[model samples]
Target: MSEEIRETQQQPQEQTPPPAQETFKPRPPGQRVTMKELLEAGVHFGHQKERWNPKMKKFIFTERNGIHIIDLQQTLQYFEKAYDYIADLVANGGKVLFVCTKKQGQDIVKEEAERCGMFYVNKRWLGGTLTNFQTIRKSVFKLKMLKKMEEEGVFDQLPKKEAVKLRRKKEKLEKYIGGIENMNRLPDALFIVDIVREENAVREARKAGIPIVALVDTNADPDLVDIPIPANDDAIRAIRLLTSRIADAVLEGKMRREAVKLAEGEEADFIPEEE
Candidate 1:
């Protein structure tokens, strides 16, 4: 025992290393739109035969168990094209309107669009929203006025019943257009989750001559969209994944725009050669 203790005393003991600090490195923009991601999110699965849109027959790879299987290769190519278009659009200070009123689409689209500082419509698509933007803007203005009045104590001076009525009206308007209250004009492009479900929005966007990037499933008319990414629109996972990729592209565009502005500012402040 004494000899073992003496041997241990001659050896150096190991020391504990410091814990790693977690650093979050974001995915490089459209890099998320990969075949692995698409497959993991069930993006290749399409609608059943009974619900399939004949217009989308060209994008279908095969028929299995009465369900259509989307061609991932086609989806990848089209998605890349769409991503580049969206990136360029945002880098030029263009706006994109995300339209997805269905329950599955509402939350994901709203979250992603807001994260990228883009506008969206997650609730009911009001008729003439694009054509009669003036009327909608009026409603949004009224909402803002009421909110400002409340903040300035104007509502406190009113009758209790009148205050309640105004508050209720504001809530109603918020449900319809809160996501787009800050939108001063029509968007440069429209990104839709379910093209068929939000057909009115698509038609309005087309009427405004705005570009459209849409998730065209087997049950959706692919020709209706300007840029169609053929995928499974019904799957929540797929929608979430694709929307995230779109949002990332927007984010990258915004970053590029800021970089360009900074570079321009630097050039403007530079001292030229006297010669």
Candidate 2:
């Protein structure tokens, strides 16, 4: 081949080397949050409360910016960080416990948990639910007893005139104790929606060594949680936003697992079968 032609062939054959592998640096803790943003967050969530104690007032101080506060900002930042942590856990086949102190918080959390296939402490955090797990198991056993009684026609055997009333009362108790029957074990991680309101649950979880992720309002002490997100605890918008973020993290983890499975399947397909 001519020199020019040989040079052209060599140029075409020269490998465009594989792209450089990207290196990922670890993110610093609390790097996602700042003091000013936390202060503003507190102000946004503080407007509805009628009264504030001295500590809360100090934490949620109002400046010339109308009502500068840190609670809302801190809560939001906390959620962001907590969600990031949760995503890592879920990616590793971990579970989360969603607990709320407010009445409706249970239902809200339950809905989210079901959507994400995670656990929740929607019912009252029964004493010894974690420390004495078998004791809580006994409660589940009682639910089995109720089921057995129903199956054996025990309710029908009651006095005919009183049977309906008795059945109604039983149903009421069952309704009140909706999610309690499922609480046979402690959660790996606990997410408390209202830290101030659910302080007892927090204490119990702490004693059991379960990691805690909580939404801390201005009135709540941040030290109670392993991961605290300062935000408007009472506002549905804020709660939904934060909870959804956590749920999204869990879903992302699930997707990652599925992708790995698919990749494995493709690899298997490429393997040669015996001749």
Candidate 3:
């Protein structure tokens, strides 16, 4: 009986129940986010060894499982530099064009950018948007005119097929330039996510002599950008964390701009008597 009891007790135990779920802890507002938070978002993770860009060798701190790891110190430093530059640009009446067309980043980019009243390209990047501005401006103008005409009941007078074609053309243009329609001139700077994926935007900005601030992964050429923040550009969480920082910086810049304008208005309001 004792031997049989020992055999039964030694039999494989049933699988243990899974661990209990943990509550989500939210980061506090206005708190200075730390490098540790950045790590939690996987910003230090990089691409495979084979895809590592030689120009980013200095930014790579180490490697694991054939993947290059970004130096968090360098990322923090570079990001601060970009943040300062963007703030100064916006405070001085400059505009920033955000380019993040990747699937994971599109919705995030649009929301963050719009929140700060900045422009973005979340859809297809229309070539020549910056380099050949005149032609693109013409199309944007036509689009606006068509919208006005529609509002005035002009489209109602057109033939059925002709109006349908016109509407389709307007939709296509909007898909390309709707976000940038309010921008009457080339952007003073461009903020790009995944420089490798949005290389066309990079090239166009370069062609137009515009400076670029980019979140560069290991697979991307960091030297191509004016300011490169080494990070995991593919992860949505990492992208969101960084872009949220940028959006905050932009909002701060806009606030400064408003303050300056208000001061100027007060100064202009004063009347000087004849001396």
TM-scores of all predicted structures:
0.87, 0.67, 0.84
Q: Which scores higher on TM-score, 1 or 3? A: 1
- The TM-score measured for candidate 1 stands at 0.87
lDDT of 3 at 223: 83
Minimum summed lDDT over a 10-residue window in model 1 is located at 1-10
Q: 1 or 2: which has the higher TM-score?
A: 1
Among residues 3 or more apart in sequence or in different chains, the pairs in candidate 3 whose N, CA or C atoms overlap within 3 Å are: none
Error of 2 at 24 (Å): 27
Largest TM-score belongs to which candidate? 1
RMSD of each: 13.0, 17.4, 13.4
Ranking by lDDT: 1, 3, 2
Relative to the unseen true structure, what is the C-alpha lDDT of residue 248 in candidate 1, on a scale of 0 to 100? 77
Point out the worst 10-residue segment of candidate 2 by lDDT.
1-10
Total residue pair clashes for candidate 3: 0
Stretches off by above 4 angstroms in model 3 are: 1-33, 267-272
